[model samples]
Target: MLVNGFYSVVSWIFLALTVFAGVALVMAAIAREDAYRAASKNTKQFWLIILGVAFAIMLLVPMMFLQIIAVIAAIVFMVDVRPALRQVSGKGGGRRGSSSDGPYGPYNGGR
Candidate 1:
């Protein structure tokens, strides 16, 4: 009985983390293609943490196949989108621009 209760609690925690990571991933995707540091770095960490948490949870509770699948999906997102975003954002080095420009706008050309 005690072991069952412990696993139940763990399952709930994993479920909550899964939901949070999934939502964060969606928000990051929506904010993609932007040169903003917050969006870029956040998106990168979001996937990394997602995969990490998913793996940890799966290791702890191998019965949760859905979590495994979520990790796979996150891996795909990380590989497919993260590199292009990092290239644009320059390794989270940050860019500067006036308020008139958009969030991800390019710097002035010194014209």
Candidate 2:
């Protein structure tokens, strides 16, 4: 009984890791290519390939070693690359002219 319980917990953990990796992969795919270049990070295609491999490994191999590597790749992309891309792409809420700027207009305060 105890062994089976431990296996179940391990399975859940693996499943969660796989899902997280999948999310990271999708985010990498959706991000703009120019943003990656502006952020001075790896090209979007490079990251896409890395994340793609990580996701595939996570799905195909349930081994702890491989999962750890995949999780690390996902975490690196989420923590480092994603934030950089967001900053370069102006999607990080960096506060532009103002709400009245109309995305590319002159601001007039509250007028």
Candidate 3:
């Protein structure tokens, strides 16, 4: 019974990680291809293939070690590559304004 309970928890954890990879896959697809080059990151296709495989591993393979490896790939993409892509595309790094910046965006005084 204890083993069954532990197994259920483990299954849910893997499912959540798989979902995370899936979300990362979608986000990677949405990003512009040029952004990857501008950010000096790998091509978008490369990330797509890695993340797609990561998303698939949890579904097609039951090996915990492989799933963990895939999750690491997804994490790298999410934490490192995505931010660089966003910065290159002018969609990240928060507001780009002086100290008078407002919540919405830059708060430029009337010229």
Report, for every candidate in turn, its global Cα lDDT versus the true structure.
0.59, 0.91, 0.91
True-vs-predicted CA distance for residue 38, candidate 2, Å: 0.2
Q: Per-residue lDDT tens digits of candidate 3, residues 1-111?
A: 999999999888978898999999999999999999999888999999999999899779988899899999999999999999888888888546778878876777874
Off by over 4 Å in 1: 33-63, 78-80, 90-111
RMSD of each: 10.8, 5.4, 4.3
lDDT (10s digit) by residue, model 1, range 1-111: 999999999878877756655654664455444443534444545655665565556546656576667666666655655555666756643565666675557445554
**Clashing residue pairs in candidate 2, if any?**
none
Greater lDDT among 1 and 3 belongs to 3
Off-target runs (Cα >4 Å) in candidate 3 are 99-111
Task: Count clashing residue pairs in model 3.
Answer: 0
Query: What is the TM-score (0 to 1) of candidate 3?
Result: 0.83
Q: Could you tell me the lDDT of residue 7 within candidate 2?
A: 93
List model 2 lDDT by residue over 68-109, tens digit each: 998999999999999999988888955657556775677677
What candidate 2 gets wrong by more than 4 Å, as runs, is: 93-111
- Which residue window of length 10 is worst by lDDT in model 1? 31-40
